[model samples]
Target: MKNLLAKKDGELLVSRIYQSESTQFEVKSCLIGGEQVMVIAGPCAVESEELLKETAFKVRAAGAAMLRGGAFKPRTSPYSFQGLGEKGLKLLARVGEDMNMPVISEIMDSEDIGLLADYADILQVGARNMQNFALLRKLGQLNKPVVLKRGMSASIEEWLLAAEYILAGGNSQVILCERGVRSSEPWTRNTLDLSAVALVKELSHLPVMVDPSHATGVRSLVSPMARAAIAAGADALMVEVHPQPEKALSDGDQSLTPRGFSTMMRELEPVARALGRRLR
Candidate 1:
């Protein structure tokens, strides 16, 4: 793979100049950036304690290495569900602990860092907050790992530099996520940008994961893109898996039901094997 670093961009801390070797670190017993691709799956938002537990159990049983749920959602409309807030975080942590799985949740405000850090094993910097320097700096100060998602309109170079903010803050445990970028096409929610998966793998040593659920925003396409992501050199995948998606509170159309996620996992196994990697 070619390491395509722009002439003027190599000075950033996230650039490959500082670290040529891949970043492999243990997060809740799973080695990210390693040969074993990890699968992090769960509902888009934590609806209820009972529902969260059911979905968490299902995704874990289907081979998800980590549990993901949104406690504080950044919705386009104020009238929509904003998430369960601290209640959701509590449920995610409670269920994850009971199941012995790591939990991941998004952090919107810098003030919520301690609150989220107390529950979420990994603090996710959503696409909207990709360039939130204040929040990024706060995450940098913490020892926790942060999953920095690419902004909907941010360039790959800009995205890497955003990760640089966290790295420069003295926290090296940062994971990059490509959750699709804004595009004019109407069929898909956003372009998945599979090339970025390969590019980031070469441009930086940090592990890159793709969010097919948000990328395609369609249940039928999530599985297909997930397999393609692994083939394109993605280190892991973040999928939205819900129980009875039709009745879900958020992103029901794009969320995969438990059965669909199971079938997707079955399809992903061979593709991962083809690359000499196993989904953890």
Candidate 2:
């Protein structure tokens, strides 16, 4: 109990203890942790320049402020498609510039920090690497913003402590993302833990975002859970949008079509407005 309480105190993040406001920062023109519930949408991976450009354009039209696509993918299987690497980062940077939007992408190691920071506007520390203190500290020293996703098996205190690793390194522009938690139920990919969204609001001053696409791992559930996230007070959302889900290189089942994403954006507006926030 004592150790748990000490963890919750988040010694390294005391400056961000939840009061009545959240820490805000700007990525290009998008104000993260601000009034609007920012949305980041794009392919799960940089399959190709054409596919990436198409998805970026569509999502931007649907009201997304920032774009996202993985360059260094951390796959569970050894034989699975390991992302396009640095080449993918170049394409992501090019498309993000052409689309006139800020972009976010994952960082798997401290060595690749310089490479990813060169292209991505917001460097994302994926769920699997949540406890990677070494990488987290490297990210903290960067001037760029970082989106830290919650580890599937980690507790809330553990998640905050991971962010502390970055905060302790001196980067205050950290956004916590809930991508769901591992569960026994096989019906859904992972339980979306909406409670965490509300809880983080009270436990920390940092803004919280949700990745419904990964949380449910089903296209149909993405939009509904996205709405729930907004109602639950998510400051932003990271959704995967592939032009054609059926042909996606990765996470196709959970990716939304361009048209489907447009429809989902339309449906999310009222929910955000009801909470006195706008769906960016």
Candidate 3:
């Protein structure tokens, strides 16, 4: 009883010091069966079924445990290429099942949850919708797991509080994603705060992942930042991969080539192993 109390007290201390969410979540294992760290890789947006399938096949072949695609994209420009919506989601669902992997796609609006949940194994909340409390609460009420990305400008407390909104709503299968934050620097699209990766692991009971592709907004920097994220204690990574990045309609600059992804996967093995984790 004394030891239990002490341990609980220790946890409380850590939470206060680091703004943690209680580090005790059961991270879902790879669907294909492995002790390796989970990797979700695919294109940033679903342009076409053929393109999506091609990228999914290559990434899965390179040992990606899950496939990612943005079915309902939240583009900055109204004139920019919007996603294919329900049709695109159907494609992702089909590809995931046919390819023998789990599917993940972003959720934007509250009304689309039921339809999106029907197809997605994991519902991803993009950084732009991090504080969409209504959506978060709705997700919390669902049975499927949610991958919540930190907002671009939200502080650590606000980020966790957003997660808390979900947790408090009753859903506990939440995965925290550090996808970088808005910063004054113009070199990188966003400043990938890897320190938050380590901090999340230390503070929350939820599995913490990183999105280096969105963080850097450049393909060349994906591998290095991915490695760093793992070193900082990320349980998973959400990377963008495309067969022909230059031809991609959205986020082409940040999507890795098949060869580049394969190389990064090879390099990630050692980092995961060194940290007492394995890479699938």
Candidate 4:
């Protein structure tokens, strides 16, 4: 009788067993879309008419290439704030039309695809849903671009496979996002995996971005990490900004004030220039 199994004691292996050739994929540059990097910035969620419009205008004026905000938030606690639902999506869509910038927001379920597709120019599949194969399959069927994040507890290979799910589904316009991952240390909300930023560019044909805001879960850390992400070869940056972080309805602690965001953009400009990339 053959012993069918040996004890494997470590991380759960969810990665597809294939080493992608470096040339097999290439990041589709947003520069081709009229910018060197695609800056997706907005509030954590769209709370109201005034707040949403205010943040949208400010970020656009500050040179963001794209806009983002969560209309359907996926919080840890059921009692915690969820989102504005389809109404929020409509607000984001209206902002896109009014401001002339592409809108990006999270899609929590497969069922919301049609409703959300009508609103968002780019659909964001958050870190929590990175490996939600069913959701990935649905997003892949859409025609819009996807901003896929690395799972909170997923490995590098697992992350890429998630991206592969979208690519394999016949949608090639995918963007990779490294938004940190859970670690034993609690100094920061999650350990920022800057190495994954480098590795993704090395391994795949997708444009990679980083979210320093969620990575640290603190306003102070956003700038430094954002600068580091650019130097580490990130194709774009996704930041959360609010006019008044202290009063924001969600994620205020991690939200950068408009003043802070302007400063971060200034510092990031030089790094982008050094990398032969332009800033809008």
Candidate 5:
């Protein structure tokens, strides 16, 4: 078998089929690839209009390039909050317009792609549907950018192939996200694979980001993991932040407070600079 990754001319090569090609795109005023480390910080779900507004303004003030939230959450349990649906998307659009920041939200059903694309600046395919080929193909047909999260149980090859589905369909504007994966250890919510961050950068040209909030499932661990992700060559970071975690309707345990997100941004500056990257 051939090596999946290698070094060429002092640069890492990821895969023969998926050769590394730098993909750069703009989100409003933020440049995704090249030298800028994009930070996308917001709540896990849009609980309320007021809360979404508060988190949006705070994260933007903290230098977040884009705001992220879930309009259609796919929960393990049916009884849990499933997001606010179109109402949440509307609120997110309003906030992004008012704040002059682009917004991203999860689109579960392929049927909702048009509606979501109309409101959200970017469409996110959550981990649960990373291999949903039909959805991936549909996203490929759209002009909007899609953020594809790595599945909890998917291997590196499998994850890249999933991205292939989107690319083959004619849309090359894809962003890969590493949000940790299932593991035997029960101490943390999920075992974050920092190695995958490095591997993805070597394997594909797609811009890869990390989700430390979901990866660690602990507020305190978020900052450290986020810092490590930047140092490890992640192109961006998607963090979950809420004004008040205790009052959040979903994923409150892993959500960071506004203050916590600000501090993390500050601490990441030196790390980003050392690596010759700028965190805006």
Candidate 6:
């Protein structure tokens, strides 16, 4: 079979790839693969109503195009704070509605698809479930856009093939996210592969975004990696921002403080402009 995501003499081989269009589509007003470098920022998990709301407002104010929070977190440890479930989803939706920004949340199971679709503008499939064929096929049937994260150990071809699962199921609104992958490196949380950003753009017509926060567990590395992702040709960025990183219930070490997020946004503007993309 021929490669579905390929280009021949500057022409895309597949028209079904959503980002192949000259004009990009909007996910509830936030445009992807457009001239603007879309930014989605929020806490890694929804710990409390007050914290979530505050983080949402802060990220929105800092020029993020959308808000992201985990209602059902998939932690490695059973003792870890495993999100607030439905209540957290409700809070995320309310905060987004109140702030007038699109909201994103992860959906772990097929059963929660309906509930998550109702609350989230974009349904995310975490890295752990990247190759969850059943879940990906189900998400493909949903009307909402899906942000498919690269698996911790998945290769570029494997990642695109996983995306094919969703596209083959008939849903074309799929956004690819590179959140780094597990590696032998001990310094950082994950070894961020920025090359994937450029390679994906060349191979596929899908809008690709990077998760610098998850890519590097160190909060200090988020800004530089985010800049590098954009410079390497990323369509958007999903950063974990919190009012108080130290107090955040999950991934606190990698989460950026409100002030830190603001500074990064400001610094990102020139970089985006240099690449002929606007930073909204």
lDDT of 4 by residue, 83-153 (tens): 99999998888987788878889999899899888888788899889989999988778887888899999
- TM-score on alpha carbons, each prediction: 0.96, 0.95, 0.89, 0.88, 0.94, 0.93
Task: Flag regions of model 6 displaced more than 4 Å.
Answer: 1-23
What CA RMSD would you report for each candidate? Answer: 1.9, 2.1, 4.6, 5.8, 3.5, 3.1
Compare candidates 2 and 4 on lDDT and give the better one. Answer: 2
Ranking of all candidate structures by their lDDT, best first: 1, 2, 5, 6, 3, 4
lDDT of 2 by residue, 136-243 (tens): 989889888999999989998889888888987888889999999999989899999999989877777898999999999999999999999999999999999998
RMSD (Cα, Å) of model 4: 5.8
Q: By the TM-score metric, which is better: model 3 or model 6? A: 6
Question: lDDT of each prediction vs. the true structure?
Answer: 0.91, 0.89, 0.83, 0.80, 0.88, 0.88
The whole-model C-alpha lDDT of candidate 6 against the native structure comes to 0.88
Ranking by TM-score: 1, 2, 5, 6, 3, 4
Off by over 4 Å in 4: 1-35
Model 3 Cα lDDT, one tens digit per residue, 1-280: 1211123434322242433344433324453112446898999888899998898889988999889998888989998888999999999999988898888999999999999989998899988899999998899899878889999998876787788778767787778899999999999999999888876565655678899999999889999999998888787899999888898888999999989999999999999888788876
Of 1 and 6, the candidate ranking higher by TM-score = 1
Model 4 has an lDDT value of 0.80
Candidate 3 Cα deviation (angstroms), residue 151: 0.4
Ranked by TM-score, the better of candidates 2 and 6 is 2
Best by lDDT: 1
Writing each residue's lDDT as its tens digit, candidate 5 over 1-280 gives 3554443543332243445558888877878888889999899998888998899889888889899889899999999999999999999999889988889999999999999999999899999999999999898888888899999999988788788778777887789999999999898899999999897776688899999999999999999999999998999999999998998888899999998999999999999999999987
Query: Which residue pairs does candidate 1 place in steric collision?
Result: none
Tell me the lDDT of model 6 at 199.
Answer: 80
